[model samples]
Target: MSEQSADPAADLSDDVRLPKEQPTPAFFESKTFRLISLVLYLGGISGLGMVLALYYLIFFDSGMPDIHLKFPVSIGGQPVQKVHEYQ
Candidate 1:
C-alpha cells in the first residue's frame, strides 16, 4: 500500500460556503404597514359593533310589538272552559 501526503489546501476545499443574510424589506418597516394594521383593527371593531347592535334591536328593544295567539272558545267537540283549571 502507498502512503498519501496530507495537504492544507485539500482541507480548505472541503469547507461549506453560506450566503450572507439581507436586511428586512423597506415596506415592512414603513408607516404603510402601520396604517393598514390600524384600518383592519378598526374595521373589525366596527363589524362587531354592528352585530351587537342588530342583536340588541332584535331581542331587547322595547319598540317591537308583543304578539300572543289565543285559541278559539272551543277545541274539537269540547268547550275550552271544560279544560282543567288551576285551583
Candidate 2:
C-alpha cells in the first residue's frame, strides 16, 4: 500500500462528498399543487375584478337608479302610480 499523506488539505479533498439523494420536489412541481394555486389565484383575481366593475358601474354610471329608489314609493299608505300609464 502507498503511504498516506499527512497534510490536512490533501486528506480533506478526498473526504468531501456530495449527497447521494436529491431533495424533495418543489410545490410547483406537483400538478395538483400547481392547479390548486392557479385556481385560487384566478378566483381571487376574478372576484376582485367583479367588485371593481360593480363599484365603477354604481358610482360612475348615472343611468342606473339608486338602491333606495328601487322600492315602490308610498303616498299616504298607498303605492304611488306608475310614471307612464299605458291606458
List runs of model 1 lying over 4 Å from the truth.
Answer: 1-25, 60-87
Candidate 1 lDDT (Cα, whole model)? 0.69
Q: Flag regions of model 2 displaced more than 4 Å.
A: 2-26, 61-87
lDDT of 2 at 34: 86
Tens-digit lDDT string for candidate 1 (5-87): 58646646555545465555598677999899999999999999999999998887566332212332666876665444333
Q: Which candidate is the best by lDDT?
A: 2
Candidate 2 C-alpha lDDT tens digits along 1-87:
988888767866565446865566688798889899999999999999999999998887667655434565779977684443323
- Model 1 deviation from native, Cα RMSD in Å: 10.1
Q: lDDT of each structure?
A: 0.69, 0.75
- For all predicted structures, in order, the TM-scores are 0.38, 0.38
Q: Write out the backbone clash pairs for model 2.
A: none
Clashing pairs in 1: none
